[model samples]
Structures are given as C-alpha cells and as structure tokens.
Target chain A: MSNKVTYTEIVEALSRKTGFSKSKSEEFIKGVIGLAKQDLDENGKAVITNFGSFTVKEVAERQGQNPQTGEPITIPAHKRVNFSAYKPLRERVNAPFAHLETELLEEESGTDEQESEVTPPPKEAEAKKEPVSPSSRKKDNDNSGLMIAALLLLVIVALASGWFLMTADEETPATDQAAIETPQTPEATETMDDVAMEENSEETNTEQVGQADSPQATEPQSDSLPENPETTEQRATGSVDTPETYQVESGEWYWVIAEKVYGESGFWPLLFQANETLEDDPDQLYPSMGLEVPELEGTVATPTSNDYQRLALASTMVSEAYQRAGKTEKAEEYARFAEKWERQSRQ
Target chain B: MTKADVIKQLAEELDLTQEETDQLYDSFVEGMITLLSNNRGFTLPGLGSFHAEVRTEHKSYNPHYQQMMKIPPKKVVHFKQSSVLRDELNEGEDEQ
Candidate 1:
C-alpha cells in the first residue's frame, strides 16, 4: 500500500470492494464532501463516526505589513475549517510509538526541579501561613483586651461621679445640723471652724454665717459674764439662738441669695416664706435690707414636686400680702409665681 | 447531512435499492478504515491529507492534587488541507 493515495484511487478501491459501479462510488464520495462543506458553512461543525470531525474556526483581524512594499496593512478576520481524526483511527495510526510510557519524578527530584524553577516549596508556604495565623490571633486578643479596659475605666468613672454627687447631697444636712448646734457650747467653735473651712473651699456663704455665729457665742465665753439676758434668751429658744440673717448685697436677687444661702436657686421661695413681715415687694429688695436665713425644715437637697407646691402657696401668700398693702402692681407681679409653680409640679 | 440522507441520495443517483445503497456506504467506510490504519497517510486530492503522529511521553501538573502527573505517549491524526481546498473555502469571504 502507498503512504499517500489520491481520492480517485480511494473511490476506485471502494467500487471494487463493494462491487458497485465506479460512477456511483464517485458520487457517494462527492456527496460526503458536499455534506461536510454545507455543515461547516451553516453550523460550523460536521462529524463522521470512526472518521474525523470538521470544525469552522474564526481568525481575528490583525495588523500586517506588506513584504514587498513594507507598508502597514490590516488583515481582515475570516473563518477557517479545521479537522481532527477519531481516537480509534489515531490509535491504529500511532501503533509504532506504543512502546513509550510516561515517567514521574521522585520527591527528591521534584524538590530539585522546583528549586531550579525558582518556585518555593509548599511546606515553606505552609510555615509562613502558620505564624501569620497566630500573630493575627494575638493582635485580635490585644484589641479586645484594650476595648475591655477602656469600658471598665468608663464604668468606674460613672460610678465615682454618682457617689461624689450623693455624698455632696448628704453633707448639706450635716452642715445644717452643725449650724443649729453652734451656740450650745463654746467648744463647738472648733468644729464650726473646720466646717467653715470646707464651706470656703466649696465657695458657699455658709463660712461667713459660721464665723458670725461663732464670734457671738465665743464673746460671752471671753467675757466670762454670768447670766447675760441675751444668752438666757438664746437658751430659751435653742433653735433660734440668733436668727441668722443675710443682708441684701448690691445687685443681688432672691434666687441669687437663695443659691448663696441654701446652695440651690430652686429654694428662692424659701426666702419669701421666712420673711413674714416683709412689706416691700419680694421681687424688689433694697441693698442692706436684712433677710433671715431660716433652718431648712425638710429635704431641700433634691427638691420634689411638693417643694414647688410650697413655692406656689408662698407666691399666693405674697400676692395676698401685697393686695392688703394696696400695692396692686406688686400683687400682679407676684401672682404669676403660683401659675409657674403649678405648671412645674404638673411636669 | 446525516447518513440516512446520504444513503437516500446515493440510492437515487445509482438506481439502486435503499439496502444496496446502505451496504455500499458501509463497505466504503470499512475500506477507508482498513487502508488508513495500515498506511502512514492518504491524500484526498481535492480536499486534504490525513496523517497519524506519535506524541512523546510528558509530565503534566495536576493542580487539584498539587503534584506532577505522567501522560503516556499517544497518537493523534493530523489533517493538512490542500491549497486548492483552502483557497476555495476562503474565496467568497476574501472579497468582503
């Protein structure tokens, strides 16, 4: 058999083998080729079992240079037909090379090949990943620890501020009790001095009141006089040893005086309640006019709605007192306090 | 076109029965396989040449296993189309 046989010779051999007419065999071959061409033109593929497949491939347009003229040109895109023979046919065709078998390199040779190729080993990559995971975990732990410490510090600050405010409220009543006990003994002067020092540091007017009361009580002790009428009078009314009075200072209002004496401007109406014989309008007070600072009978540190109610009642009383004095303008000015207090209590 | 279509067309052209046309087609296919398997190559004058080639054994990487794999030597059929056929296939499109 020849290495290459022409199509006509194949048709001649087919006609002889099948005992068919040569013309009919040639027609069959032509039909097969035509069918392949039509299939490739239409669907871009044609398959013949045990023979081969024809496929149409697209070649893209590209830049080209003409060899003779040396001028740049654009090559147009086009379709091309490709062919691949079947596996069984290929196996039979390649029988002469069947003895060749593939070989795999061992581990040592594989590592040597990898080194020559300049690719890192998988074990080394794994080693690098192992350390990175722990370091990232440690960083996460550090971040979480820092967040927890910051949260703890915030909670402690909140608790400490709450405790300080509570103690400050509790200390106000103790200072009031010390004031009431001031004239009982001359020895109380030392305690009063200590309380006054704290009041001065706190920027309150209680220090001046303490100093004024202490001097009066200690003067009698220094004189060593027996049975003074003022001292006997002080003993008779222990609660009101010397009515603690505050002289209205220049540019001072009732609320300002209240804040100075009681440490809270909300107790402003307490000033009006203590001064029963005050004929002048409570809103209008002349400097140097004496206003009494009465003992705080109830809880005034955290004033409740009841305190606002007391203020409303005190406003009504002042309005009535102004009306009795025939000061209609003063009465009208004070009348708004009842309405304001009522609104405050409702809230 | 399918084998049935080719058989019918061949039967009409040859003035033969469908069974004879079908038998004739089978004989042609068997003759081609026998001739091609024995010879190195054959040329279809108007179309192309069919040749068998032997691929050498080679190493290939299996990415899924992260290891090297072996591919044994194998045979493949190669088709080199004739200039006449190639020119004919591209003739209509070249004008565009």
Candidate 2:
C-alpha cells in the first residue's frame, strides 16, 4: 500500500470492518467532521475520545513593521485552529520510537574547576611557543604589530602606484584593470587614514576586530577553505544555482542591477564597487558586461544593523566620487541613498 | 464534539441505534489509530490529512536545575486542514 490512503479507500476499509454499506460508512465519516466543525465554531473546542481535540484559538493583535519601509504597523488579530491528539493515539503514533528514553543529566560540582583546568593547557602551549621575559614579550608584540602594519602599507602603496601608472597610459584597458582594483584599495585605506593617525594604531584596531571574529571564523575555515575553489567552480558552471555574477542585459542600469542583486535600487554603489569598471562613467554599461556580485556574509533578506552601516559607507563613497567628478546631481542622489542607509543603521 | 455527543448525533442523523453508532465510531477511531501507528497517512477528501512525523532528539539546558536534559526522539501525528475546510472556517474572518 502507498503511504497516502484516500477517503474512499478508508471508507471501503471501514465498511469491510463494520459490515456496513460503503455509502453508510462515507455518510458517517462526513457527519463526524460536520459535527466537529460545528462544535469548534460554537464552543471553540471539540473533544473526540481516543482521537484528538480541536480548538479555535484567538491570536491577539501585535505591533509590527513594514519590512520594505521600516514603518511601524499593526498586525490584526486572527483566529487559529489547533488539534492535539489524545494520549493513546499519540502513543500509537510514537510506537516506532517507544523504546527510546529521556536521560536527565546530573550536574557535576567540579564542572567549573574542570573547565578552568582544561583552559590552562592551551595557554601553556602558547607560552611555550613564545617563552620570554616581560620586556621581551612587549617587544615581540610591538614587532608583530609593526610587521602587519608594514605589510598593509606596502599593499596600499603598490595598488596606488599601479593606479597612477594606469592613468598615465591614457588607455581604456589599463584603466579597466585599475578600475577593478581601485575601488576596494582606495576605500579601505581612506577609512583607515581618516580614522587613525598611525598605521600601528590601525593595526591594533584591526587586530581587535579579528580577535572578536576569530572564534567563529576559525572553525569554519579549517575545513571549508579546502572546498572553496570547488564550490566556486560549481557556482560558475551551474546556471540553475544562485547567480554569483550578473550579465548586463540591454536597457539595464546600475539601479536595475542593484535591484536584481541586493533587492534595493539604493544599493547601486555596492554594485559599482564590485565591478568598478563603471567608476569613470557609471551610466555607460553595455550589453554582455559581466558584473561580480560580492557575497555578503548575511543577505538583505534579514539584514542586520552592521549590513546597513556597510551599505551606508559604500553609498557615501559613491557620493564622494561623483562630487569629485563635478556631477552635483548624481552626487546628491547617492548622498540621499547614504542618508537613508545611515538612518536605518542607527535604528 | 465529545465522542458520546458525536455518537448521539450520528445515531439521530443516520437513523441508527445508539449502540450501533457507538460501535461504528469506535471502529473508525481504531482504523485511524492503526493506520497512523503503522507510519501511514490517510486523507479525508473534505476534512484533512493525518500524517506521522518523527521529531529528532536534542539536549536542552534546564536553567532552574542547572543541568542538561536529553529529550528522546519520537513520532507524532500532524493534521493539516484541507483548503476547502480552512476557507469554510475562515469565511467572513477578513471582513471582521
């Protein structure tokens, strides 16, 4: 027998078991459901011995927000129908797993001591790796911090130098390459330089962020890093999968691409940063142009405040870029987008 | 409706004796229980479908007792209402 036994089949089975006509059995089944419905409607509850009970529950009205606009709204109250099976019927349904037993754990008095003892070995291992007096340890910390800052500074210098060289060429190809590299490098360094006086201070702030992120990040990276390339290959070839890049179609603009990718027209700046070939002229997108869609850790389906902050920063950069290019109207448009995202982030 | 109330109503509607109606109701409940216990689902055309689903076991911390309790996995019956029945029940709900 297949899993789903239909109504007629059940009636047929009922007739065979009860020595009643099929029509009579069907009528009985219909009558029971009708009565239960009436009972629930009138009394808000119905009880059937050895079967289950049905209840009509009133759900109170609650405050909510319109997801698109972030405007506060009221969710109207509603009625919900609920069913709970009787104990005998519940036990019958659970027959397959009846042998399983719940286990209550006894709390151990030494749990705190055990955790403290467990934590020391890892610290001891780290200490063994860098055995030093207090002064030497401080020196080592400074040296490591300097090393990171120096590396980041070198990367920024190299990218800036490359952009300058590309500008000197006065050709589209070099500019295209530079444009792709320019958006990320300049934006990152701009924020760092604006906020901090020294590279060493920037390094310390970055280290704090890294430390905060590492506990969750390290466990996934240990195994997933090896599989990343294969997954990217799959994504590139699989047309049915979630698209990682969008090919610009005829009549499409930055707002359309932004809408398609991030579900908001205001997020065009994020799209610009992903491609950056559109940096010089954001409106000159041609057909068959492939634009990368940067994979965000969390999608806008349920955006966090942190996501809004990042989007606001991107929008602000686009506004600043347009202002520098002497396009006041376009700059103002992006500035409005930045303001909207900033307000959302604050909320 | 209580089982006795249902039996009485069925007896009146179908022109059957109380004893016969009671027997028929028991037989129906027995059949449903047997089908569900065997991990098979049944659909009543205008009413609904009854299916058994297995819920996985998991450990939950009991903050009051300061200990973890492991809940064992088990199968449970779920009833989904037919659209026709749902609409009938929710009729004029939106107008309210």
Candidate 3:
C-alpha cells in the first residue's frame, strides 16, 4: 500500500503490452485528454466507452463566509465538473486483492485454477466447536433465555394494562350519571314544579269549558250563516263590475315582458292555455295583439285591464313558439305574464 | 506478449520477413495514435474505446485549513477494454 503507482506507469505498461511506441502512446493520451475537455465545455458531458462519464453541473449563488475574516460574502453561481467511474473501472480499482484471495482458496480446497479461491470455512466444524467452553458459553445461553423471558413478561403486562383501560372507559358513563344526579339548584327545581302546575290548571279549565259550550256552539253556526247570505251575494256581484282586462302595447319582446312579470320565463305556457284562439307558439304575436288573462281558479280574482291584455297576448305568442319546439322552459315563461296581468288588473 | 515474440509469430504466420513485420507494427501504432489525436477517441475493432477526459473547475475542500477551496480541473487520459476483450481474458471464470 505504501508504494503508490501513478497513472503514467499504467499507461507505459499498456503501451508495452500493445507494442505502441513511446511517442505514439504520449500523443494518444494527449488526444484523449483534449477531447474530454472539449466535450465538457460544449455539451456539459463527456461519455467515455466503458469508463463511465464526466458531467458539468451548475452551482447556484449562495451566501458564504470568508474563513479568514469571518465576513459574509456572496459566492457567485458557477459550473462544476464531476466524474463517475463506470462498472468495470470500479471493479478493477476497488477489489484488486479479490483475485489473490480466490487463488488461495482454490489451492486450499484443491479446486481447478479457473474456480475462485475465496471460500469460508465449512459450517459443520464451526458449529461443532461452539460448546467447548462450558462456563462462558453457558452464561451466554442463560442471558439469551432471560432476555426472551423478560420480553414475554412485558407483553403480558401490556395486555393486562390494556384490559384495565378498556374496562375503566366502559364504567365512565355510569360515573357521569351519578355525578349529574348529585347537583340540584332550588330555583331550577321550583321552575320545573311551576311548569307542571300551570299545565295541570290549563287542562282542567279546557275540560270544563268543552262540556259547557258544545251544544250552544253547534246551534249558533247555523243561525249566523243566513244573516250574511245577502252580503255574500252583493260581494259576488261586485267582482263582475271590475272584470279583468289585458291590452298589448308596442316595442316588446314576449320573452322579456314575460320574464319581467313572472319570476321565471318558463310560466309562458299557461298564457296559451288561457286563450284557446291563440296559437300554442306564443312568439308569433305582433304589437297590439289582445289577450284575456285567465283567473287562477279558487284564488282571489286578478283584474286585467285592456292594455294589460295586449301585453299578455304578445307574451303568450312568444311562449307558444318556444313550447312547439319542445322547449318547455320557455313555454312556462308566458304563463307567468298572464298571471302578472291578472294580479295587476285586480289591484 | 513480448514485441519480439509478436513479430516472430507474425513472420511465421504470414510468411513475411522480420523487417516487414516490424514495419507493419510501427504503422499500426502510428495509425492508432493519429486517429486518437484527431478524434479524441480510438476504437480498435476487437479491443475497446480509448478516450481523453477533462475535469473542469470545481469547488473542493482544502483539509489542511478546514476551508473551501477551488481546485482548477485538469484533463486526463484513460483506457477502457471492450466486452470482447474482457470475455476473452476472463474465459474460464464463472461470471457469478
């Protein structure tokens, strides 16, 4: 190990082996060196056959301190080069003595020269000699056995602790219930009693009243209705005087008018249903087209004036066009317009 | 093999004179050197590729003072044997 050989020596030996002249060998070596430099500078990599590659790497700029002055300095970013030895080079350099060991082993085992000499001793001999030293050997065996027993005892203790923890958790709910019952405030207790007394009084009063009023309540209901019959007829006749009317006006898209009146444009379909003479496609209506806003059955009457009628007619025409094209969403829009006109007329 | 032994063998095999064999050997060496000088690598058909490598500027440690140091990279030459040569040389050994 003390006698370190240089690369030159190896190259000289190679030249001798290959019958290359001294000058030629030097030139060849120089050529290889120059090429490697050029490759790194140009492409950032130099790939040598069977000898691995050299790569150029960039180092980022970083903060560094001057060792001498301990002053902070910015180390400017730079490129660096590195070499990685290939598999063959690594094998040759790392374990040169491997072959020697193989040779020695082969000689000892009486194997062919081609076979590697490095071999460990037979296992049987090593095993048989183990029990010879009784005191130390026995101590070693006892220590191992003690270790195993200690481990087993630890596992048992852990299991027992886990069981205790689980049972303790299960008892917590019962302990909580006992804690809850032990706390009682006088005011809270009084409030609960008051609520119970009030409920009892209300129930008793309701039962007494039900018994006293039942027959009389039934008799008054029939007598009161006839007295309001004339007034009900007058109210019904009053609605006919202010019948709802709708009128169409100029410059309005049916969809726009429908959307403004109804929250959704989809209510237009109901407008077509209200006016049987109008086409199902509501978009065909021109300006000034008239329509009757239909009353929503069983609801308060919505009055539609003449002007409102025309607007409702236009909205229905647009809605019907959308409906005929299988656009149910647009058809529902005009329906809302008629409803809006009816509401306004009633107002 | 020795140079003399190689020459004598070549003479015997090719029926050439010793002087002619020597000339042939010299030309081969010169040719290989020239090829490598121009291309930076030489590929012998059954041997392997021989190439030159360079180590560029890199940051390294100067252990003496426990400080970072810049080691200006240097160029070097290396030889690599081909697979064919490796197999032939290690013919009898078990690969594993």
Residues A260-303, model 2: lDDT tens digits: 66666766777766554313456656543445566555665756
Candidate rank order under lDDT: 2, 1, 3
| Model 3 residue A240 distance off true place after TM-score fit, in angstroms | 99
After superposition, which runs of candidate 1 have C-alpha atoms over 4 Å from their true positions? A62-75, A97-101, A107-347, B57-71
Estimate the Cα RMSD of every predicted model relative to the unseen true structure.
50.5, 26.0, 44.4
Task: Give the alpha carbon lDDT tens digit for every residue of A1-347 in model 1.
Answer: 23565677777767755678888888877766666666766787876655778887778898989989999988888766688877766655544333333333334235454333323233444454455435544654678756644543443344345434543444433212232332232222233332234234332332334233233333443332232323432432354322355545557787887776666675666677665432335566544334556655445564467767777877776776678768998788667877887788677
- Rank candidates, DockQ, best first: 2, 1, 3
Best by lDDT: 2
Error of 2 at A70 (Å): 13
Highest-TM-score candidate: 2
lDDT of 3 at A344: 56
Chain A accuracy as TM-score for every candidate: 0.29, 0.29, 0.27
Query: What is candidate 1's lDDT per residue for B1-96, written digit by digit as tens?
Result: 677887787688767899988887777665555455444366765566776554545678755434564555555677886676666667777722
| Order of quality (TM-score) | 2, 1, 3
- Clashing residue pairs for model 2: none
Once fitted onto the true fold, the runs of candidate 3 whose alpha carbons sit more than 4 angstroms away are A1-11, A96-347, B1-96
